[model samples]
Target: MSKSLLQQLREMTVVVADTGDIEAIEKAKPQDATTNPSLITTAAQMPQYQSIVDGVLLDAHKQLGDSATDKDVANLAFKHLAIEFGKKILAVIPGRVSTEVDARLSYDTEGTIKMAHDIIGLYEGAGISRKRILIKIASTWEGIRAAEQLEKEGIHCNLTLLFGLHQAIACAEAGVTLISPFVGRILDWYKKDTGKDYKGADDPGVQSVTKIYNYFKKFGYKTVVMGASFRNTGEITELAGCDLLTISPQLLGELDSTQGDLPRKLDPEKAKSLEIEKLTIDKATFDKMHEADRMAHDKLKEGIEGFSKALESLEQLLAKRLAELESRESKLVSAD
Candidate 1:
């Protein structure tokens, strides 16, 4: 008889599906869809996406020549595979898709910028305009610098793996299209640190996003804040008035089935009156602030390494599949 929690949140925030699964995205019907290396790697193993995986590998071998080494094939496949998935997601969602560049390029400013351009080019080549894609990058100093340059070039970016105020402030200053401050991950760090469980408004993750949201609104920054990596429905609801929230399919299902009184926890009007001072974050200041905040420093590094490992696992998978395809082709030739 009443509006579902998801519907309530949508009225205040843009709902985005945080997944690489087409069916999940369809069911969630989120305005935007986001994919990372981990999601892509997981999707590659699914029986349904096997054809797409093989097709991308075959396209790699064809374009790079059969003599291309496994490493070469894997490298090419990674880029194409990300774009391939992004293209499919774009078909179902009308808003935009956040496709990440390689995590290995996180600390490399110039490399991140160059890859962002190439990714946008790939989308354009496929007839999808640049307007429909957000090039997601880490929130390291280098990554923020890269995003700054990309923004000037009209390439929107989603600064991800953000934890501390330093990261959020830098992102807002950089004029990023959006910033994905991980809500659940922050809670994980705090819980492990103090061995205290938190919930609802008391959740540390919820507090972090609220601070960033209020800070952004108070300062009148045009950069959007999209809270991500939610661990539960409470965290999502606490950030009710965020610019956006990229929710996992699990939470989406939970929210869809549950109906309750949902209230707007954050409002720009309330934020404007908060007396938060403007914090200037140059490289030195950012490094110092990052070092002081153990949570942000450790979590950012962990996130990057995790994504990098996932990417490596994906490359290995591609190489193994490539070898199998080659073997099948050789056997067929012998029979002929």
Candidate 2:
């Protein structure tokens, strides 16, 4: 029997699951798993995870006491809930798990660093090693700086929501453990901008990741490039030799079912022969480059807003659930 595309890809690239669904992760058996606010929100809605949500809310209420405001409860609950989900996910995947900080802290370097520490501490308190977790932060300059500091302290970081070469280069300089350069989102932007249907290697998203992969390999940057947010299996196959690829369960299944001739599209040796220039980007240059690349600048802002909105939605969900729990407790007390 011929090997499926997914199997073929795995032989060359490390497959990571970009989901919070435990069942899905188990079924796919990915080496690692990544969770963002949106994925966490989706997971919280499932009946199986209701206990995890309720447990964190109860803990938050007890810790904050009766004087706590809804905001306090929600914020603390979110932190606990994210860690709880991460712990559960760690049990299934043999490798590390990527748990993100709040997107609103994307531009706050100090806040991001502190949150990274708090999250890692939580993991450590739970008997999970810090080495098994990747503190996922946005690819903003501030976030990259935070990752640089954290990376020095033996905490690995995953720079996410990355779009362009500038972001990739900055992350490489920061020595991030990994970078999730979004492939699907870039394609979406180009498609809407140009109104052209792109496919396979012609896809703007595929081309973007390929460029980053080649650049990284060319310069001998140790930072891992994990192409993320894939729109189709074609994009995945196009960058088969990436350091890692965090794929959605849907795309993983698609690749698993399809038998095909998967070829290596990226080669480090080829990158070395391309005669690429080494460029340095300070704060001023970084800002200028961002201003020049309208697509990356606009998309980075959109991605941050989307994640922030999802986090806000998660807060609201926790508030509602906490109220329901309080109401049930009040009813029991009245009966007593």
Candidate 3:
């Protein structure tokens, strides 16, 4: 009997779980796990995650004494939450966790770089080595530049919201550790505009990732390519041989249940056989490509906005909690 489709793909690609749900990740057994601000916010709302949040608050109280500012408490709380998740996830997977920097700092090069270091510091404080974390950032030119500097300091980066070859080339030039080309977001733009559905090799999103993957493989760039934000099983199956794919658990479970024949779709040999010529871009060339690709440019901005809003919501939640605690503390002091 032939091996399962998922089993076959496992040989060619590294499957990563794209989520903050630790239990789901444990069940899926993906080699790596990735979390963004939105995913983190989602996880915090779950009843199972209450203990993690409580632990963070308890630690913050112990460390800050009687005068912890709301912002300080929030930052410490988020850090603790990230590390707690990282710790749990590390036990189930053998690979790193892609923890994102604050989305609001996406355009601020120095701030993004500093926050990246701070995130690493929190992880190290938890006794987790730097090797097990990939500091995730938006794939803006600024973010890419920040990642470049961070990589030299022995910190790995996962460049997210990437939709164009310009972003990919910039990331590669910056010597980023990895780039996450969003497959579904690209498809979303096309689908919404044209009212057309794409499948098989005809998928624009799949093709975009394929182009980037092939380019990286052809040039022997050390930066890993991870296809992310997938829309369906077809998109995932089409890019089966990508270096890594951060898949949602729903699609993963779908793949797990299905028993179809899955072939190696993204072989380096096949990429080499393609007619794509070697290409490199300077700042001017990169700008021109960005100008030419409307979908990439629009989606990149939209993704950043969505993430920023989610981060703002998280901040508000933290602020409300802090205020309530402060009020309760004042009442207790009066009673005493």
Candidate 4:
């Protein structure tokens, strides 16, 4: 029997499942898993996870007591809800699970730092070691600073919404644990801008990640490069030797079904041999490079807004569920 591409890819690079779908994670048996607000919102609606969702609402409602409205309880439950999904994912994946910090705090250094601590504390209180958790934050300068401080205190962070080399360099200089460069989203921007088809290594997204990976390896940065938001398996196969790749379940399924020669497209030793200029990543440099890269600027803002909206939608879902549960209990009490 020939090895699947996924199996071959795993032999060369760490494969992380990028989703909050626990059953899919369990079935895939990925080494690590990642979750974000949009994914959690989708997963919360899954019938299989209804109990988990309801449980969070109930806990938050009780904690806030009778004075809290459903909206207030829903707000409280939203944070805890992420931890619950993360815990379920952690139970299946042997390695770490990346639980995201609230996206709305992407630009607030203090808020990002504090939320990271609270998230870690939540996992710790639930008996999960911080070692097995990666607090994911946006790759804004402020968020990177937050990760830097959290790293000093021994909390690992995964800088996300990363699309440009400047953001990647800033994260590496921050001594962060990991970074998730948006591969498919970059491809999305280019295709929309140029109205051209991109496949395999020629894909701008794949090239972007490859550049970041080579840059990191060349400079001896320890921050792990995990290509994320893949649009297709071709983009994934093109980044065969990335430190890690967080793949969606749909793509994972496709890779599992396909078999072919998976060659190494990236290597640390090769990167070390290549001459790459080291760019300074100070605040001004980062801002300048970010501004020059229209794609990064637009995508970063768009990604943040999309995530913020997903979180809002999730809050509404929680509120509706809480009301239903509360009304049911009230009717029972009156009947008694």
- Scored by CA lDDT, what does every candidate get? 0.94, 0.93, 0.87, 0.95
* Order by TM-score, highest first: 4, 1, 2, 3
Candidate 1: stretches off by over 4 Å: none
TM-score, each model?
0.99, 0.98, 0.93, 0.99
Model 2 over residues 145-237: C-alpha lDDT tens digits? 999999999999999999989999999988888999999999999999999999998999999998998888888999989999988898999
lDDT (10s digit) by residue, model 4, range 1-336? 999999999999999998889999998899999999999999999999999999999999889999999999999999999999999988888999999999999999999988998999999999999999999999999999999999999999999999999999999999999999999999999999999999987999999999999999998999999999998999999999999999999999999999999999999999999989999899999999999999999999999999999999999999999999989999999999
| lDDT for position 297 in model 2 | 98
Any idea what lDDT model 1 has? 0.94
After superposition, the stretches of candidate 4 with alpha carbons farther than 4 Å from their true spots are none
Clashing pairs in 1: none
Ten-residue region with minimum lDDT total, candidate 3: 1-10
> After TM-score superposition, what is the CA distance of residue 159 in candidate 3 from its true location, in Å?
0.6
**RMSD to the hidden true structure, all candidates:** 0.8, 0.9, 2.1, 0.6
RMSD of 1: 0.8
